[model samples]
Target: MAKGELVQAIRLLTAERDLPMDRIIEAVQEALATTYKRQYGPTPDVRVELDTDSGEFRVYAEKLVVIETQDESHQISLKDAQQYPGEPGLNEMVEVEVTPPNFGRIAAQTAKQTILQRIQEAERDLVYDEYANREGEILNGIIERVEPRGIIVNLGKAEAVLPLQEQVPRERYRITQRLKVYLVKVDRGVRMPQLVVSRAHRGLVRRLLEVEVPEVFNGTVELKAIAREPGSRTKVAVAARQEGIDPVGACVGQHGVRIQNIVNELNGEKIDVVPWDDHTDKFVANALRPAQVIAVLVHDAERRAEVIVPDGQLSLAIGKEGQNARLAAKLTGWKVDIKKESDAGGETQEAPVPPEPVAVAPGLPLDPADEPATMAELLERVPNEGRDEA
Candidate 1:
C-alpha cells in the first residue's frame, strides 16, 4: 500500500472497530519500528511518525544537546541542536531526522511484514468487538467448510466455529450455503477471539420466533420459557401483555406460517407454542400440549406435580418414549409424573390372592400358570352370594 493508502486504511479500521485513533496510530508506528530494529542494529532513540493527512512516515532520532557529551551515542553538540531549530538548554533532547543509506530490499520487506501483521491484529480486534455482545442473538453466516468435528461459518467480520454438539443431528450443511446460527459464546482463549455458534440451543428457537413474530420483537409478546430436544421437538411458552391477544395464536401466525418457517430452518423439527401462565398448574398443563389434562396436582414445596389424563389420552400425554412429559417438566421447572385416571383410581390396596394349585389331568403332567391369574378368575370361582363370607 502507498503512504496515503496506509493512512486511509488505519483511519477506516479505527472507525469501524471503535478503537481510539491514537492507539491505532501507535500500534502501526510500533510495528514499523520493530521491523526496522530487527533488520538494523540496536538503533537508539528511534522514533516513527505517520502524517495524518499525507500518510508519509518519518524516522528520526532524539538526542540530548550537551556542552560536554557524557554519552556520545545519544548527545549532540549545542551547535548541531541549534541547526534543528531547537533552543537547547544545558541538557535538553532535540529530535533530529535520520536517513539511512541503501534501505532497498531490506526496508521493503520489513515494511511489508510490519503492515501485514498490524492489519491482521487490527482485524482480529474488530471481529472480537463485533461478536462479543452477540451472545443469545442470531447471526447469519456462510458455510466456509465442514470439518470432522464441526462446521466453520464465515460471518462477514469473522469466522465462527459451530461444533457438532451444538448442531442439529442430521442437518445437512453445504459449502457456501448461508445459514443462521445462535451466538452461544465469545471466548478469547487463543491469539484471536472465537465466536462459538449453536443451532440446538433454546436461544436459537427464541431468536427464530423473535424474527418471525412481530409481536415478540415489539415486546407485546414475551417468551417465558423454552424446552427443546434438538432435531426432534421444542416447546415454548409465551405470554401477552395486552388482554384479548392470544400469545400462542400470535406466535403460530396465519395457518402456522411463522412456526413452519422456524421448523424448516431447523430441518423439520417439531415445535409447540403454548400460552404461559403464572399459575403452576395451568403452566404445566400448557407445556404438555396436544394432550388433554384432566387435572394437575402440584406440590409447590417440592416443585413436583402429578398430571392426570383421561384413560384414552394416556399415551398422548406421556408421548413416545416419554418425551412429552420430559419436556413438560423442563419447561415448567417441575418434576412431572403423568398418570391416567383409571390407573390412579384403581391403585387401592387389596389382600393378596392365594395361588391356586396346578391342576393335573388324571395324573398327566401339568404346565405352571404364569404368576397369578387375572382378578376375574378369582371372583368367578366364588359364588355370587358367598363372596362376602369368603
Candidate 2:
C-alpha cells in the first residue's frame, strides 16, 4: 500500500468500526512487529514505529554495546556502535533501524489478516465495556437466530444470547421478531463478549414499568416487591413515595394503558398491581387481590399470617393450583396460611406448628403430582421462602 493509503485505510477503519484511531494504529504497529519477528528470528527487542500523519513505518532492534560482540543479533561492538548517530559506550543499549528492504510488500501481504484480527479483538473489548455497566437495563433487540441452547438477539451494536433457562416458557421466538430484554450480565467469551440477556427475569417487569409509568420512573412511586411465575402471572406491590400520588393508579395509567403495555410486552402475561403497606397483615391481604379478605392475623415470631376470606372467595384466593396464595406468600415475604372465614370461627387459633421443614431447595417449583391439597400445606412445604427484591 502507498504511504498515504495506509493513513486513509486507518481512517476508514476508525469510522467503520467506531474505534479510536490511536488504538488501530497501535494494533497495526504490533502486527508489523510480529511480522518482522516471524520473518527474521524471534527477539524481544524489536519495536515498530509508525508516523500517524505520513503513515510511514520503521522497525528498530535494540542491541547491547559491548567491547566484544558474542551474539550478532543482540549485541554490537563499541567501535561499530560509535559509527551510528550517538557515540556508544560499552554495556549501553542502543536502537538501530532494521527495516527490511521488502518489508512494505511483506506488510501488505500479512497486514490485512493480522489487522482484522486485532480490530475484532478491540471491538469486543469496546462492546464489553459498553454493556458491563448496563447489566440491569432493558434493551430492545431483534431475534437473530434460534439455537438449541437459546435464542440469539441482535441489539444493534452486539448480539446477545437469551439462554433457555432465562427465556419465558410460553413465549416463542422467531427470526426478525423484535422484543425487549433485560441485560443479565456480560461474560468474557473466547471470541467475543457474551451478552447474557433474559426475557423471564423479574427485572424485565420492573424496567418495563419504569418505561411505561412516569411516576415509577421519576420515583413518585416505588416498587416495593415483585413475585412472578414467568409466562403465568406476576404480583407487584407498589408504594407512594410522594404524598397525594396513588402508586397503583399511577402504574395502571388512565384506563389501564400503562400496565396493559407491559402485559403486551410480556406476551399477555397477567399482572396484579396492588398497593403496598408497611404493615405485613395489610400487605398480605392486598397481595391476595380479587379475593375479599375478612381478616389477616399475623404471627410475628414465625413471619406467618393466617388469612381468612369469605367462603365464596376461598377458590379465588387459592386460585388455580394454589397460584394466588403462593404468589401472596412470595410477595409479602411471609408464610401465608389462607383459610375460609367459617373455618377460623370466632376463636383465636394458635399458629399451627410449621410441619417439619420441607427439604426442597429454595426457588425450585414443586412437581404437580406432589402439590399439597391446600394453600397452608403448600406454604409449609417450601423452606427459606421469600420475595426476590432483585
Candidate 3:
C-alpha cells in the first residue's frame, strides 16, 4: 500500500476503535522491526519511526558513537555525531537512518497482521471488562444456533452460550428467536471471552419480575425470595413497604395480569405469588398456597415446620408430584412435614365422617380427611398440643 493509504488506514482504525493514532504507529513500527530482524541478521539494532502528518515511515539502526572504534559494524566517531545532530551523546548510541529499498512488501504484510491482532486482543479485553461487573444481569439476545450442549445466543458484540443445564426443562428453542437471559458467568479463557447465559436461573426469574413490576424496581415492593422448577412452576415471596398495599395483590396485578406476563416469558411457567413475612409461620403458611394451612408449627432449632392442614387441603399442600411442597420448602428455607387432624388423633368408626367443621370440633372426632376445616376446628382437635405463637 502507498504511504498515504497506510496513513488513512491508521486514522480510520484509530477512530473506529477509539485507539490513539500514536499507539497504532508504535505497533506498526514494532511489527516492522520484527520483520526486519527475521529477514536480516539480529546483529543490527533496529528502530522505526512514522510521521503522524505525512504518514511516511523511516527505519533507523543505532550504532555506538565511539572514537578509534575497533568494531566498524556499529561504532560511529564523534565527528559523525556532530554531523548527525540528533545522534546520541558520549558512548551513547546514535540513530543512523536506513531506508530498506525492497523490504516494504514484507513490512506491509506484517504491519497489517500485527495491527489486526492488537485490535482483536484489545477488543476482547474491553468486552471482558464491560461484562465482568454485569454477571447475573439480564441480557437480550437472538438464538444464533443450537448445539448439542446448548444454544448460542448472539448478544450484539458477543456470543453467549446458554447451556442445557441452565435451560428450563421442556422449553423449546428455535433459531433467530428473541429471548432474554441472565448472565450466569463471565470467564476469560485462552481461546475466547465467554459469557455463560441462562434462561432458567433464579436470577432470570427475578429480573423478569423486576421488569414487569414497577413497584419492585422502585423498592416499594421487595422480592424476599424465589424458588423455581423452571418451565413448570415458580414460587416468589414479595413484601410491600406501605401499610395499605397488599404485597400479594400488587405482585399478582389486577386479576393476575402482572405475574402472567412474567410466566409467559418463561414459556407459560406457572407462578405462585406469595406474601413475604418476618414470621416463619406466616411465611410458610403463605408459601404453601391454595392449601388452607390450619396452623404452622415452627421448630426453630431444627429449621423445620409441622404444617397442619385440613384433610381436603393435604393433596393441594403437597402438590402434584410434591412440587408445591418442594417449592414451599425452598421458598421458606424450611423442611416442611405435613399432617392432618385425623392423623393426629381420633377413633376410626364405621359411621360416615362428618363435615370438617363438625369432625374437628372440640370433644368431637378429629377426622383429618374432612375438607376445608376451619382454625376453630383445628385448635379443638389438637388435644393437648400447645398453640404457641409462631
lDDT for every model? 0.70, 0.78, 0.72
**CA error at residue 269 for candidate 1, angstroms:** 1.6
| Alpha-carbon lDDT of model 3 | 0.72
Best by TM-score: 2
Candidate with top lDDT is 2
Q: List the residue pairs that clash in candidate 3.
A: 342-368
Task: Give per-residue CA lDDT, model 3, range 77-171, as digits (tens).
Answer: 77777788765577988888766787666666777898888777666776788787887689999999988756999998788887666676688
lDDT, residue 270, candidate 3: 82
lDDT (C-alpha) at residue 74 in model 3: 72
TM-score of 1: 0.76
Q: Please write out the lDDT profile of model 1 over residues 1-390, one tens digit for every residue.
A: 566776687677667766666766777677666665666656677887768897666777778888877765578888667777647776788887654554333444455565556666766777777787776689999999987747999988788888766777768778999989988667653567777777766777878988999999898998877777778887777889888888888888877788888888988888887777777777777777778777777788998988877799899989999988988887787899888878877432322222211111000001112111432332233222111110
TM-score of each: 0.76, 0.81, 0.77
Model 2 segments beyond 4 Å from truth? 1-11, 42-44, 51-56, 66-72, 76-91, 348-390
Q: What is the lDDT of residue 115 in candidate 1?
A: 54
- Ranked by TM-score, top first: 2, 3, 1
The window of 10 residues in a row where model 2 has the poorest summed lDDT is 355-364
